[model samples]
Target: WLRAGGIQGRAILLDYASWATAHSIPLSPFTSQPIPLAHLRQLIAERSITIRRGDILLLRTGLDAALKRLAPAEQRAISTRSSPDFIGLEAGRATLRWVWEQGFSAVASDAPSFERGPVLGDHADAEHTLHQWLLAGWGMPIGELFDLEGLAEYCAAEGRWSCFFSSVPLKVPGGVASPPNAVAIL
Candidate 1:
């Protein structure tokens, strides 16, 4: 990211929060809810998403909006957790296989991490990490904690999921990560 500056391309938003709620698929941003592959495929089919190579997958877990609604003290409690946890895509073989086969250029989410938090547990031990699978293995970029509430609404209102996405990352030479300034054009 530092060398290349940032990533930009056709981005697709899978508003799992809205879909799950409408379908009555229980989910919470605070707990460690692993979004199963079946739900994702179902979501794609329902939304008529045509998966394509080099597409950037932008997943909305509703974490950003959820945090905003919390009281200050409750928000602090979450931020200060020693074992930070949040809802995210499932971390396992099936999901990883699907991600790879889909040939996404990059993946991002409103959650803290693409795959569930507490990456050290089954996520790391099983060797199904986005860090390893997407970044190291497939050389795909990962995004997290993006403010996407407005984007979600715009997409819904526009009745589209795909967008022209771009990001401007701080040019900190040799830095590992930078907060991404991202935008999506419907």
Candidate 2:
């Protein structure tokens, strides 16, 4: 049980708008691809995005826009579908090393989960999934279903990925989770 209020830090948005726009496959989010670490690094360098220690990483998978295009009935049906899948950061030792080295305070994404869903494979000594590594192992909070479209657009227009971010969760004792109520300021 992770507390949402504990997760707060400077926010940075990694926009994959182009990728999402070009691909329009329903049922699977962003075609169920895993964002390679190299590609991620390339994006940061290309965009001149600077990541600092203790910063929160906000990944924009563009799932929100994709979902909105679906009919309400379709959306409802998809929502209830078992074994849903989506594109997200890869879960592995390399990814863990990168995140640890970069010193991200926490990681959040617009997708359903921070890491790709239906995670299948033998992850030997490593944690079964990124969710386990981040939340249980690292004690880092993970935020999902974030509305990052506006932020991604704003960052793109401004040519800045970093922003002053703040979040406050409801102070409920023994609460497992709460709305982030997060805000970002340029």
Candidate 3:
């Protein structure tokens, strides 16, 4: 990230990996979590961490098992959407508000969609809401399905809070989400 002038030692990555039950159980982070966005905001605020526009946020949601169950063809089909999970629009709005308040300019998650799955009610536009809110609303791009546990453990061990984060996405026009190969070099 130094090459890109983002390595002045103030990068933080958030985890966004959550698992969906074999039976439908609201897989999105916004609704399923005991500690929702408001609580997350409070936690960060208490820690004196500031989220700003253009800042990179990493999220970890344990959805890899579900991904593995999909056939290769199925996985390809789902990738066309902005996210693999269904995050509701209301939740999307709430998340955006918190993200902006925290000062994040960018966000990433381990799940396919940043929103909840099987989106219900009038908010059928869950995925759309998530993409538009972050990309268009916050002017923040998003990274999808990143591998964060290993690097997070490393960071925890080293007692460091900053690193160089980089991602390369496919140059596909009209693509909602890009298949990216990303890495954080500490």
Candidate 4:
């Protein structure tokens, strides 16, 4: 995957933070806020976005901005939690089905993981979550902890959410994961 020109595709941004703010919905990255499949469709319909095959789905859950505002102690607390929890895409059979049907090349998010963290006890159908299915089942790439706030700002200002996205992962043979040098061109 790293050797091959990497991943290049039409990327769509679902600005969940903006949607939640506009609707007076509360969200916290420290909590298990699952971005529902229905809500994703809602955003697509509301923005009149057309889904296409091989599209890279970018989801902004406001986690980047939220973490930026926290003090050092608060950040430390989150890092040191016994069973850390944070905002992420909802996990379940339904989520898996929708993602497969959409035919996304890969999924990326600003949260710590593409799917919710601490998947042991919190999520229903934890075994069928994205981390397991995307990585193990389909060999799909899942980008996490991406700094999407700047992208969000730019998109909001320009009223354009679609862009050309690319990323070349670190060239580590047989590596499970690697931080990517990802870029998006508006």
Candidate 5:
């Protein structure tokens, strides 16, 4: 249907870390899969493909698995804030630098924030460095927690490298990020 709407194309799809699979909830076997960051970087390098500025870079951390385990009240609390068990500052900085070097317009993850949670360590004590660098400095709007398993499967089978992406966000003003009701047709 989307292809009929002029959305078909070849593309390389990336699936980020999934908290559900990492935790072994078995909701989606593909979501549970892990594609190392280095491997992803290598793929781009091998292809000599540069991530253009304004391109979307999605990161899947599998945090949703943990998010699912929490009580509804706990989930609400974390919707705006991240737990301390998330990635750390050093890792976040390195990740941010990599994404910036690749010239991505935005960098996103399944976890709430780009940096690790406060509970995990003291490194992320600073107020969201990842946000400052990607959003304030680079003018990139990060997308979070997108469902990518289906899209990934399509790309893997067809060996495409790029596809048209479409999305619609809620009209709420001053929103930082909205849950993805987005898709890539290939």
Candidate 6:
């Protein structure tokens, strides 16, 4: 929908160090930490990433890679955890505002959901999830389970966070979701 709406633009990758640290721990895949707004701001500044209207934001949380390392049983167990958790953007007004203020056309991450799981018990707005706001309210497309390890490494080596990202989803009428056949070019 973003493409159809002419919302495509430069893509920026946010590579958090936690991804690497968590990958070294075998059981870390079962849980995720929250990416604070302050930390996000610092990362953007430190990486010299310039946010523009309609840009696509790709967050590298390493959840995909970590899950790949887990045993089948471990994966199944984590998948069914009550109130499952994973590292992602924190749930709050600040996060919602940050995303809106940035004017991103879409947001993608290596985590399962774009936002932290087991939604915060004290969140001001309990009725709506980030998914609801981003996808339903803002009409912003959200991508999850993206394999960004290679992209992150390349960006780090070249010190370039922005890229030309293109994705082609299966054209299925009435389809609610489809795999993201995506590519990123520096």
| Candidate 6 residue lDDT tens string, 15-111 | 8654335335232444656776787787787768899888999998777877888899988988888876887777677888889999898999988
For 1-186, candidate 4 gives per-residue lDDT tens digits of 567878998999999989888878899778877778888888888888888999999999998899989999988888899876888888999999999999998999998888777665746586687888988899888999889998999998998889999998887877777887999998
Give one digit per residue, the lDDT tens place, for model 5 in 1-186: 222332222223444333334335343211213233565675555535446555666544446655677899976765555333453223455566676676654455555454444423444425436666666877766555656556555654765545667655554567555555566666
Q: Of the candidates numbered 3 and 4, which has the greater TM-score value?
A: 4
Ranking by lDDT: 4, 1, 6, 2, 3, 5
In terms of lDDT, the best-performing candidate is 4
* Model 3 residue 171 CA deviation in Å: 1.6
Q: Clashes in candidate 3: how many?
A: 29
Better lDDT candidate (2, 5): 2
If ranked by TM-score, best first, what sequence of candidates would result?
A: 4, 1, 2, 6, 3, 5
Question: CA lDDT of 144 in candidate 4?
Answer: 90
lDDT of residue 63 for candidate 1: 88
Count clashes in each candidate, considering only residues at least 3 apart in sequence or on different chains: 0, 0, 29, 0, 20, 3
Q: Mind giving the per-residue lDDT tens digits that candidate 1 earns over 59-118?
A: 999889989999999999998888878888887778888998998988999999888876
* Superposed model 6: Cα runs more than 4 Å off: 2-8, 18-29, 120-124
lDDT, candidate 6, residue 63?
Answer: 79
Q: lDDT for model 6, please.
A: 0.78
Name the candidate that leads on TM-score.
4
Off by over 4 Å in 3: 1-10, 16-35, 42-53, 65-92, 119-128
Cα RMSD (angstroms) for every candidate in the order listed: 1.6, 3.5, 6.4, 1.2, 7.5, 3.3
**lDDT of all predictions:** 0.86, 0.75, 0.54, 0.87, 0.50, 0.78
lDDT of 2 by residue, 32-95 (tens): 5676677678778787888999999988877787888899998898778765667777787888
* TM-score for each predicted model, relative to the true structure: 0.94, 0.85, 0.61, 0.95, 0.58, 0.85
TM-score, candidate 5, is 0.58
| Runs off by more than 4 Å, candidate 1 | 1-5, 122-125
In candidate 1 the C-alpha lDDT for residue 1 amounts to 46
